[model samples]
Target: MLKDINLNAMNYFEAVARLGGISKAAEELGVSPSAVSQQIRQFEQQFGVRLFKRDKRKLTLTLDGERLFQTTTQAFRMMRDVRSAIQRQRENRHFNLRVSPSFAVRWLSPRLKEFLDLAPNWAVRIDAAPDFSDFETEVVDLDLRYGEGGWTGLHEEAVVHDLVLPMCSPGYLEELRALSDDPIGQLRQARLIDSVKTHYRWDFWLARHGVMGERMVYPLRFDRSSMALQLAADGAGVVLESSTLALDQLESGALVPLSTAFEAIRFPAYWLVCPSRHTSRRIVRIFSDWMREAGRVHDARAAELITGLGCRIREQSGRQLPGEEYVGE
Candidate 1:
């Protein structure tokens, strides 16, 4: 039976082997040359072999030394890997969810509380980025983005597909309600609050209805969709934006949809993204399922609040939006 070896001495031996000389290994280890040499000698003596054959300043490993080095090197590396893995376990309670600024404020922020309340033991860190997260490199456990489906190399699931309608506060809505004789004419006259950054612009939506706000020399410009929706809710101006973003305001009667021209944008649907490998994780699966259901519920609630053109939407019976289940599963 072999005796237990000194781990520290073995480390010194490994360093010597890696560096190819005792003096250099000593410098790297922040130790005196004599100390490293002595440690190396002791390690070799314990193994009962001449591990290295020295020539001038060169230290070449013998056959026996090569075999020992191969085993010990792998063993030491495994020790480091084990320690690192354990350290990760001790402090890896939080998982990251990268989201767009617009989605973060308008949709995700309110719903996050529910997730936190539900999963008290698990922590979620939201990284609200203006641009897309690099799923190939970034430590993004999940991402929420607006895009057309078929995101290659990553797992994605459509969360919400909402109608873009003209939204405004109660007084503004009431004003539009009075012009029921010519709703489009009144809408064209009003100060168009435009979300400048979005791909689906007011021009695109207006052209569809055979009328463009072409007469307006300058519309109020907000850089983000969430900002436009908030301003509109505050009775700032009429913002043509997604109903999903303004769902809370719509429900609260703070903001109301001005037109029944509910245009469902095909592209740029809200997609929950992650590396394909991560879907198998329990927490990820749980969050994915929860988010999809929550989106459905939100849409249903938003649909209930749509009072446009002197009409409220009463679903014929259990009628729901076209759903996109989690693509990862």
Candidate 2:
């Protein structure tokens, strides 16, 4: 019967063979030199063969050791390839999604149930942050970005086109109604919550409306768009936000639109960004379909809310604005 060989000892032997010294192998393996030497000794004893000729300053592989190293190298290489293939298969069965924190919290979280319902067996890992760059090196399977579809070297698909409108909580609207007869004038009097870092700003929305007065400038600045939305929800101030993120609040009466004049910016509605090189894995394709459906649902809801509130939305072509009667699912 062939003797059962110790795998750990063989691994140590392989490391030493590749490195040419126990000290080097130890350093690579993050173990002590003594430990590597002991493992080599154990391996030699098991095989009943001296695998190395050790001098005061150097070590060389024996004839038997050379032959063994050749066989073991091929063996480990095959094992490594097999392991990698298995890992890729497992990853194909799952998805790692990355999104901006604001989109994840204000937009995705509210609608994730629908996605889960559609993809019951699929597992998802959401890495939510403001940054959505470097998806390829990070090994992220998918990313959602809030920008124009100009992410160079990435495969991007438009999820939804966005329109920015003034939104405030019901309490703030009540306060405004109490303070001033003109809602727009009252909005100027109230604190204006702003997201200056985003490509789409309140100033752009104001410019579209031809209201480029000093009131277009907001005093309170928020680093994240989500924070500005939350503050607006809390009745702190009016926020110019995407209808996609504010749909739930608007539908639930938590937030009210100040006016019907919403501006559709050239900024990417929303983008599903992925590495240009990565072919669509099964999980990624599934998630992509889910995202497309989610965007449709969001757009439908936003349109519904906007129509119900009698809001006017301009199309990208700069044509005459569509009438409220023309808006539908």
Top-scoring candidate (TM-score)? 2
Q: What is the lDDT for 152 in model 2?
A: 70
Separately for all candidates shown, the number of backbone clashes (residues 3 or more apart, or on different chains) is: 0, 2
Q: Write the per-residue lDDT of candidate 2 for residues 1-329, one digit (tens) a residue.
A: 33598889898899899888888999989999999999999999988999999898588999999999998988988999999998887656666788877778877887788777776766778888767657646868888876655567889998876666788998888888788877556766777888764555666556656655565568789777777887899988898777777767777888888755443332346778888655457667777888887777767667766777878666553222232111100
The runs of at least 3 residues in candidate 1 whose Cα sits more than 4 Å from the true structure, single-residue gaps closed, are: 1-88, 174-180, 261-268, 307-329
Residue 278, model 2: Cα distance from true site in angstroms: 2.4
Residue pairs that clash (backbone atoms under 3 angstroms), model 2: 147-268, 148-268
**10 residues in a row with least lDDT, candidate 1:** 320-329
Tens digits of lDDT, candidate 1, 193-295: 9877554567656776676656653358877787888888888778877767777777778877675554334233578888889998777887888889888
TM-score list, all predictions? 0.63, 0.63
RMSD of 2: 10.2
Error of 2 at 226 (Å): 2.4
